[model samples]
Target: MAVKDRDRFSTTTRIRLLGEQTAARVYRSQTRRQARRSRLTSRAALLALVLCTLIVALAYPIRQYVSQRAEMADMVRQKERARQRVEQLRDLKARWQDDAYAEQQIRKRLHYVMPGETGYVVIDPDAARQSRADQGAADRPWYSNVWDGVDKSDASDQ
Candidate 1:
């Protein structure tokens, strides 16, 4: 009976030890997994921080680069316009250098004719009448017109 009691006690003690070992193994594995998860979370957080910082730091320079490119495009357009204007002026200058063009301009603007040429003056009667009606102090002598303007300014002041 004493031997049987000893075997029973030893068997019970071994079972208890086995249960405790299993519980300890499960706790250790859980802690290790939690540690791995924390490390991963920290790494992800750092990566996100780095990305945010990069975006903030690059934002202003990127914006400035885009704006400068737009400004450069505008400047190029203005330069093209100026070049066209220069080309037009050069063509006009070249035209004016020709004696025939100069003569034509003089004839058209100043109503000039060569000595042997008979020039006919065409008049619009209505336009002539309107001009005559519109003529006032300006048609008078310069001295009289000046005095008339002075008189008008004086009257307005009064």
Candidate 2:
């Protein structure tokens, strides 16, 4: 036999080694890409979750703000009505403080007979019947009804 070349490897062994190295590299690269993709997907999901939480948390406060604004508007309207009523009452008070106006109101309401002047009351039959039936608020004192009428008329002056 010829002398053996111990340093020389077989061609099949070199080819097999190269194929195994390539397979390992491919597997590692695929694993790295999958890991990166999964990481990105997780981050996106977390961002979405945070956004949903923020929306949910602010919903009640937003509703409360809208309702409070409506209530504030109603209160402002009520205040305006009250202010107008106050101004009307002030004007009526000034008018009633006059002697002639007070005497005229008393004469009209009470059907009082002045000196040498005749006073006659013309009552509606239906109203008289209703008053007799207690349907009218005549159980109260006449002055109370008059004062209430004065107050109501003052309010309507606005």
Candidate 3:
């Protein structure tokens, strides 16, 4: 009757129904947001994997290309050095072809003298002292140093 009608049309009953509908809508929206977040995460992971794969695939070839460029530069430097050396040798050969240069080299190296000329050598005092000091080791052959090393090793083992 009238009481039942009053209960159905009460303000509190209407407020309760509206609140429930709002809560349901909020829940649905939260689930949709979560799904979207998961999809975006998967896409980001796939992109990262693709980038890593590309870096790995190109790594070795890029390294080899850089190393080859450096090697080519080194070879070019060696070629230039060799060309300079050949030029120097050619100039030396030309100098030696002259008779005066040949005589000068013979006089300097072999201490040779012409028939009526005096051949006196002036020695530096400082250089003579250095030679005297080095006579203990520098004047000796390399084999002597090696044999001394062997003797020291034998003495140490004893």
Candidate 4:
């Protein structure tokens, strides 16, 4: 009877100790999980920092690269335009080299005619009248016009 009482007491004590140990293990595991979560937050912060740093470091260079590419394209367009201008000038030079074209340009610009050809000028009467009205006394002979200008200036001075 004393042995049975001793066995029962020991078994109850063992069960109580086991339960305490299991609770301690669960508490330790929860603490470890919280520590791991904190560590993950720090690591995430570091990753975000690195990403922001990369963006700051690379932004100016990326912008410059894009702008330089645009400038290069503009230079290419200017080169093409210069090439077209050169071609146009060469064509104009070729046209000017011809005697017939030169003569036509002279006749059109200077109103000249070939020798022994009668060239008639068609004048607009309204334009002629306007010009005559605007001529005043200066359309006369040079001496008369000068005398008239001198007389006018003398009269103004008096």
Best by lDDT: 3
- CA lDDT of each prediction against the hidden true structure: 0.85, 0.82, 0.86, 0.85
- Give the runs in model 4 whose Cα sits over 4 Å from its true position: 1-29, 124-158
lDDT of model 1 at residue 83?
Answer: 100
* Model 2 agreement with the true structure over 29-117: per-residue lDDT tens digits: 99999999999999999999999999999999999999999999999999999999999999999999999998998887665667999
- Count of backbone clashes for each model? 0, 0, 0, 0
> How does candidate 4 fare on TM-score?
0.61
lDDT of 4 by residue, 1-158 (tens): 89877766897877987899999999999999999999999999999999999999999999999999999999999999999999999999999999999999877656678999997667677657775336656343345466767888999999
Worst 10 residues of 1 by lDDT: 132-141
Stretches > 4 Å off in candidate 3: 1-11, 123-158
Task: Mark the 10 consecutive residues where model 4 has the least summed lDDT.
Answer: 132-141
Q: What's model 3's TM-score?
A: 0.64
lDDT (Cα, tens digit) per residue for candidate 1, span 49-90: 999999999999999999999999999999999999999999
Off by over 4 Å in 1: 1-30, 116-158
Candidate 3 per-residue lDDT, tens place, 1-158, comes to 99878977999888888899999999999999999999999999999999999999999999999999999999999999999999999999999999999999888766688999997767667666675336565444455566777888999999
Better of 1 and 3 by TM-score: 3
Cα error, residue 106 of model 3, in Å, equals: 2.0
In candidate 4 the C-alpha lDDT for residue 98 amounts to 100
